[model samples]
Target chain A: MNPPVYFFTDFSSRGPYLGQMESAVLAVAPQARIINLMNDAPFANPRASACLLAALNDYLPENAVVVAVVDPGVGGSRKAICLNIGDRWYLGPDNGLLSLLVSNAGAENCSLAGLHESYMKAASASFHGRDVFAPVAGLLVNGQSPDTFPLPVDGMAGASWPGELAEVIYLDGFGNAMTGLRMRNLRDLQGVVVGGQLVKPAYTFSSVPAGALFCYENSLGLLEIAANGSNAGRILGLEIGSPVNPHISPGRSKNP
Target chain B: MNPPVYFFTDFSSRGPYLGQMESAVLAVAPQARIINLMNDAPFANPRASACLLAALNDYLPENAVVVAVVDPGVGGSRKAICLNIGDRWYLGPDNGLLSLLVSNAGAENCSLAGLHESYMKAASASFHGRDVFAPVAGLLVNGQSPDTFPLPVDGMAGASWPGELAEVIYLDGFGNAMTGLRMRNLRDLQGVVVGGQLVKPAYTFSSVPAGALFCYENSLGLLEIAANGSNAGRILGLEIGSPVNPHISPGRSKNP
Candidate 1:
């Protein structure tokens, strides 16, 4: 059986864009399980969203097909591409949004390809999420090989980007701040410094007192700034791309 | 075949709450097609959310099970109920959130019922969406009959409420404001007076010039206020539950 398809985009709340995307997918694979992983990706900031998409990779079900769209340059000269990382499939614009995913998947095991522009020849130039990428995702979920629609180029535009990012990537509804820094390798780290505030690491929300600010490994397996019973985003004045400094206590090794 | 399940809630944009609801549904029916209709419903205001949920009902597929949650009174004396409106199933709190649906379905065809509270005895008093409603929806989707889980009452708490509402029930991501008035019975209606501004109607976004405010039938088949190229919600300072007075043109009969 084909794995479920996960949709990640910047469509945010409201509008017909998200629903139309689902319709396009259902028209092809009527029974496919589609998950709206996150619709509120940092708007138009694909670099920040790239880190978010990478950090979210750990929470996805096995062999999921993720159709990610954080494209600010949709109708322009940017290419439309797909990447097959092991059993998982990633589809979206050729912007740097897929950089971290490709880098984390170990570029050696992944192959990048693109679709024919003719597929979207009739689509509105402004709404490619509904017209172009959704249909492409529908086709992929039906077991079509990415190599069947090859691009003129070999690698994605941002394939050479770094593996980990240190900036604030996303802010959740609860005001928790998620940084691009992976929690995999950090050892003996005392706290995270955001806006000059030292937030100590706790095991979970209940580990800290109500209204207390702290840092912890979130369900997505990344270091997130959170308050036990309040909105951390509002208190910290955090935003996408905000600089987050991971404070390592003296004599602690920086390497994982 | 079971129709897809649509999720409407006030969970906002982040947290494990919404995802955990999907997990509960998928656990019972692994291949269930779950759609996140909207998560940012008006917080805690079920009357306003009921109007929004009612307006959204037209856009849902046939026989779709909607697990609507806008319960501000969770873990209180409020009841958890389900309504079978034709082929569609609506499940959530008894705080008038499903009132519009029951009223629209004409009450007689819709029989009110509730699940045994023992099903939720193990559930956190806070999140019945994950523990109770989702599991019930999964059972219904897998062909369990509504008659199997009957409530003590025959009618919903808000069954006798008005069919049409004249309030701003929801605001979309594009900054459009959606009212609770259904367009089906609005004949000879020229415009809507919102915040003391009389906005005219247009066929589509392009029908008016840029930054023009107009009321039209939205994708959800409800009257909505929108700006051609600008944010209408920002321009009009509109919000959920904002009073909107519908203007029926003089000398035009009010008949449908």
Candidate 2:
């Protein structure tokens, strides 16, 4: 059975961009199962998108082919690459979008850089996510080998980036704020301080009262600030890449 | 060959909700091609979603299984249904969400009233999209027949609703405003009167200068108001369900 293909992009699902990308993939791999992991990744901010992708990676199927393109650098000199991180495979650009995933996968992971010039030459000046990466991803999920296509590399382009960022990486449609810090980092933390408001930890949204701002472990295993039945992003004046300071409760054990 | 499944919903793609729904479908139909046709449908406005779904249907493949849920009346006594419109199949609540599709497909179409009580009985109070529709859609694309599930009906609920809604049904992430009126309805129309601004028609965004407000036949064949390379929704003061008046240019032929 073919592993499902997941699409993660900053391409907002407006216009015909996303549809054209999906058509390109289906044209090559007709029998493939495609899941749109996200199309609304933060626009043009690859650094923020990288952290969101890493946090969201837990939900993606292991060994699946992921086509990630948060590329603000399309049509530029940026290299198109593929990464084989453990069992999962990713086809995207080298613009730091896949950095966290590659870095987190550790020493055993490998990247194949420089998509064929012939493929890039024929790709649209603006939409490589559709013309170039989609076909490459389609071919890969249909069983093409990385060695047969690109130059292999031991390190990814942005693999040297930080393990965890202190900035808000994504704000969902419901106004929940997803930070770069992992939930595992909250062992000694009692809450989050954002927009001049100190919010406490809750197990889930239901644990907090309506309109109450709270921090909780989201399903993505990230520290997220949300309001019960409300828009926390609007309430706390948070946006993508907003700086957040985690607060440690007095007497809380760091290792607990 | 299994038919592709498309999800058209008001359920914002923010949390684990959409992911969990996808997991349910994949659990049953592991090889299914699932497309997020639109996750950000106008919330709780099934009338608007119905129009948007109808306009968007032109892009979906025939015989596809579409799980459309815009039920503001979820957990209420509203009936869950299955509609066989031509070769396409739709599973959703009967609260006008699928009405446009049903009405547009004409008399040859058929509907199955009342999803099995056992299915609805097990559904969560607030999320029938995951509990009832997802599993049902999975079984369907995997070859289960509508005949084995529910009672047949000649007419669907809300099928008598108007063909065109002169209001904004959705605002895409790019801030383009998609009206419920199809371009076909504007035979004599020269422009639209939206937010007291007379917006003229253009072929494409690039046809006009940057920040110039214009209306065009979008890929979905709907009259979408956009500003060249700018946020149209913000500039025009338009949002989901905002009303607009179509005006005819004097001396212009209606047939044009």
Candidate 3:
């Protein structure tokens, strides 16, 4: 059986880009199981997006092929690459969108390679997500190996970037702000400081008063700020790349 | 081979609803080909949504199953329904959401039925889209005849609604406003009067000046208002259900 293909891109759901990419995948793998893991990743910021990708890594199914594309530098000199991390595969531009996940998996457990020349040659410079990465992911899911050569992990862009990012990486439809900071990365946190407001943490929305701003570990295990029964992002004036300072309790460092 | 399942709903891409519904579909039809046709339908306004759905009918592949849920009356007295329109199957609430398409198909080519009680009993009250409609769609796609009974098309809700709606039904991510009025419904139209501005009809965005509002037939064949390089919806303050007036040329009726 062919494995499922997950799409994580900066392509907003409104346009034809998401649908066109899926069609490209289905063109190669006729019966492939496809899912839109995320179409609203932070547009153009690979560092914050890398952290978000790593946080969502645990939710991916075994033997899945992920097409991760947050490329703002499309049609540029960025190389198209694929990485075999654990049992899953990731195909995208080697512009640090996959760096955090690769770093977390350790170099030995991850093998990186550039995509074959044939796939890249026929692709349009502006839409590699559809022309290149999608087809490569479909080929990988169908158990066909694309031509590639091994590459050193350290040479990847953003390889030396910090492990955690303390900024808003995404804002969901419900107006919840998802930061790049993971729940496990902090200890004894009192609250988070954002937009000059002290937003306390809560386990769930109902635990706090209505319209109250609070931070919590969301389903993806990322530190998310939300407002009970209201739009937290709007109320707190937070947007993608907004700075967030975790207020750790006294006698403890911010990061473990 | 199982038919592809297309999801069209108001469930924005941000939350887990769309993914959960897809998961429910895959649970029943493990090998099903799923596509998110549209997840940002006008929230809770099925009248405008119905017109939008009818406009998108031409894009569905033959033998495809559509799970459309813009149901504001979900889990209420509304009945879960399935409509066999032409070669495709539509599964959703029996509200006016399906009325426009049913009416457009000439009741003779359409067949209506109520979902099986077994599926409804097993579903949660608030999320019939995920619990009930999704699984039934899976069954239909897998060549399994789900238990359903015949119903009269004339008795369905919204059966008496108009064929065309002269209102903004959707605002895409690009800030373009899509009206429920089809392009074919107009004749020798000079411009559309929306928000007290005369948006001249243009063949494409390039034909108009940058940031100039223009109306054109979008990819879906709907009359859409857009700016050359700016957001027309934001500039014109058009939202779902916003009234749109079409200015036909002299001596011609508004509707052809």
Candidate 4:
């Protein structure tokens, strides 16, 4: 890892605090490989997060620490956990992020997934990614055990109520791309977004009419806008961090 | 332009010749931008060249002369011309490339879209982008006239034609992107290429359910192959410059 620590999050909260944590990593690790695994993970969908992780797991640097925070129940009784599974370590709220991995193991094998209170930093009502998750992840990457921070909290279930999956993270030039949406949720939708500003009219940029607004399942399996003769990005007036408000017909599953 | 003289072509026939011409541009016009539009244009489609032109049109420096070559009916009775539309000049065969620009302006109303013969190299074939086009574009950037060389071929009609609309060109890592095929040509596709492999399902490293092959429009919007859990690039065995066959789907049409 050229850059030792890799932090992944939805960037929902923790502004300068995140930056400060990054600075701490810089000072200590000095060689962190901070791969951005989509700061736009949907509000709180383990599937979306899992999909993203599933998509990127094979490509991440070997044995790199993957820190993700998609907590909607940040300051509740939810227990923050550190898990070691399949040669990788995950530190975050014991949300459903590990469900896929655990399910894959089939035998319910356990390997160091515990939440400790000693690591809590004032336990703010929100912002665990900055206060708890980031710091614990930093320590874990340096070869410290999950217990190095805290003892496993008992009877504290995480945010795992499989819900409606919604997300629109990245928009690229040609207005033909929007990455990070769960395609499984949108594949059946005949919906419109942005008050019909973005509509799924065709399958790809080619299928969409020129100068007409159209949506499709981009290879990323996310919603995207495109123009046959021009760029979708300029047309929609969006850049890296623009939010997508998709309006679907027949609506989505409320939670995929 | 920091680099002068751009080359966009398949270059199957005029590779070394264009290389010499490019060297000549840098040797002669160091202050100019010598961009590689491409050496991997599809067989013969002026619209493909046009898509490439548009993709780079906005990012180019003022007065930059873009040199392109997609001459299939080269030695045939096609006329050679240089078109000055908007703020830049395009030096290539007077084929449908300029026609693709019809959405903006007609080729007949060119500012300096004329022919020059005196600057032509002796014993040159119809592949002028190398011997004729590249040198001429370089000369103009080096400060010369539209008439310093040859007279416009009298009655050389730059008439229009109707075909697939060219929109974007691929920009590969080595500066060679297999572009020129518009989205109109890529829809409902079963398999295409990247790093020289037949690709289908688009999967992410982790999302891939172990041993699944993945194919998707890479970050660059060109078809790419990636494994969900492994390096498909290494597993399926591909490297840069390998052919990515984005074959025309059975339902492909000549329209967008």
Which candidate tops DockQ? 3
**Residue pairs that clash (backbone atoms under 3 angstroms), model 3:** none
lDDT of model 3, residue A16: 88
Query: Per-residue CA lDDT of candidate 2, range B22-98, in tens?
Result: 86688578877788888888877888888988888888888899999885556667788887766788889978788
Candidate 1 docking quality: incorrect, acceptable, medium or high: incorrect
lDDT of 1 by residue, A1-256 (tens): 8778888998785644576578667756776777889999987788888888988887787789899998566656777787778888888888888878877777677777776768667665456676677777777788875333754333676767776677788998889999887776577778888967989999999999999999988888888899999999899888888888887768876664
Q: Which candidate comes out best when scored by lDDT? A: 3
Model 3: CAPRI class: incorrect
Which scores greater on TM-score, model 3 or model 4? Answer: 3
Each candidate's lDDT (Cα)?
0.79, 0.79, 0.85, 0.53
Quote the positional error of residue B126 for candidate 2 in Å.
11
State interface RMSD in Å for all models. Answer: 5.7, 5.7, 6.1, 17.5
Each predicted complex: what DockQ?
Answer: 0.11, 0.11, 0.13, 0.02
- List where candidate 4 sits over 4 angstroms from the true fold: A1-4, A12-14, A44-51, A97-112, A121-125, A148-256, B1-256
For candidate 2, write residues A1-256 as lDDT tens digits.
Answer: 7877788887776789878888898898887777777778888888878888887786566667889998777889988887777778888888888878867776545555567778887789999989988888888778876433655353556667886877788887778788888878668677788878888988665566768898877656778888877789999898887888888768775335
TM-score leaderboard ranking: 2, 3, 1, 4
Tens-place lDDT per residue, model 4, A71-167, is: 7677887667776656677777776664444433432353545667876756566777666766666666566655544333322242332222344
Listing every candidate in turn, what is its Cα RMSD in Å to the true structure after a full C-alpha superposition? 7.8, 8.0, 7.5, 23.5
Off by over 4 Å in 2: A109-113, A146-154, A251-256, B1-8, B13-24, B33-256
